[model samples]
Target: MINPLGIVITVLYYKIAEKIKKISIFSKIPPIVIAGVMLIATLEIFDIDYDIYNESAKYLTIILIPATIALGYPIYKNIELLKKNKRIIYTGFIIAAVIAILTTYVVAKMCNTEFIVIESMLPKSVTAPMAVEISKGIGAIPELTACIVALTGIFGGVFGHKILKLIKVKSDVAIGLSIGAASHVIGTARCIEEKRESQVVMASVALVIVGIITAIIIPLFIYLIK
Candidate 1:
């Protein structure tokens, strides 16, 4: 027979994590669920700090990359749709790139946020790992950038359709580009679910283009302003 204490601990921890993950409040927000589990576990356990877990978490995250790569299979399978609308898709990507960078820079500046904060915020629409690296390259806080990126993705995924509808966006290509431009990876996931071929392409383009743009623009702005 197994030890009851071990089983009880395992069940309790899993139950807590599952409850948080399944709840409507947390279901749509992956970053929050991930963070919540770590927070709760740390608080309930002995002598475990975020720093300690963070050092170890890098190893855990390596396994997650392959899972993310699996998401690309659907996009590859839908290449016919992507090819048919190449013109509209490319135009949408270009426009989306311009809007994402400019709006983020303008809003952060208008809010009187710090230059580094603004720099970090500019890449908040990119995938978290990429955003963190971009923030570091531009002399911003990686942790802050990661948090903002996660929040931006969650907001974009949850409300992208509403915003698109409100703005009367009619083209599927345009809609796809908008989601990719504003939401990054999470938005890409939503696009995949909708079978939006244009979006998948634009999202891939947006991730690369916007990342490159932010890496250039934010640093240049800091130098010019100072």
Candidate 2:
């Protein structure tokens, strides 16, 4: 039987984390990161195996599919904007994907990373499911790929706005595309917080586009290089 206790504990932690995020000092920190840290510490203190926690928490992961589909509402509401800028959106997505892949490969090579590590890191910019699949196809570790994907999302969620400001990225479309392409759902969440409908729409669109492109291109590229 599935442990109902685990689900209860997980939901409680998330609720507490959300409240904590509303505090002035913790406002900037993403709730997922906070909850993750809290969960890790709690597990360590109790000497709980991560695999056991994962098994207990599997239902939450399943909810993510429907949650992702729900993001379409914002995009659908802003359909006209997306249609108006389809060309630019597609162009920017392609460019961002290319740069992301090349930079990951180049940095891994420069650091003298192992072949498997390079392959795993190559899909770090996309969503976790796609990243894991791409990593598996390229003979990389799916677990490692998932880790990199999560880190990318967290880092982008936390610091993406500051980076964009530093680079003087003024366009909403550009901001949305860059964050979504680089950080996936976490970045899209950040974009939604901006309280701008257009940005949310563009971010959602960019995320879907980038995920699709990464899923299609990375495997082919790996095959060619091998």
Q: Which candidate tops TM-score?
A: 2
Model 1: CA > 4 A from native = 1-26, 31-33, 40-49, 58-91, 195-201
- Itemize residue pairs with steric clashes in candidate 2: none
**Residue-level error in angstroms, candidate 1, position 154:** 1.3
* lDDT per model vs. reference: 0.67, 0.82
Per-residue lDDT tens digits of candidate 1, residues 20-77? 7677776676644475456556546776555555554555445545754564565576
- Candidate 2, 1-226: lDDT as tens digits: 8877667778888899999989989876667668767887888999988788878787776786676567567667767876886888788889888889989998889999999889989989887766766677778898788778889998998899899999899888789889988998888888988987667777777877787788788888888878
TM-score of every candidate: 0.69, 0.82
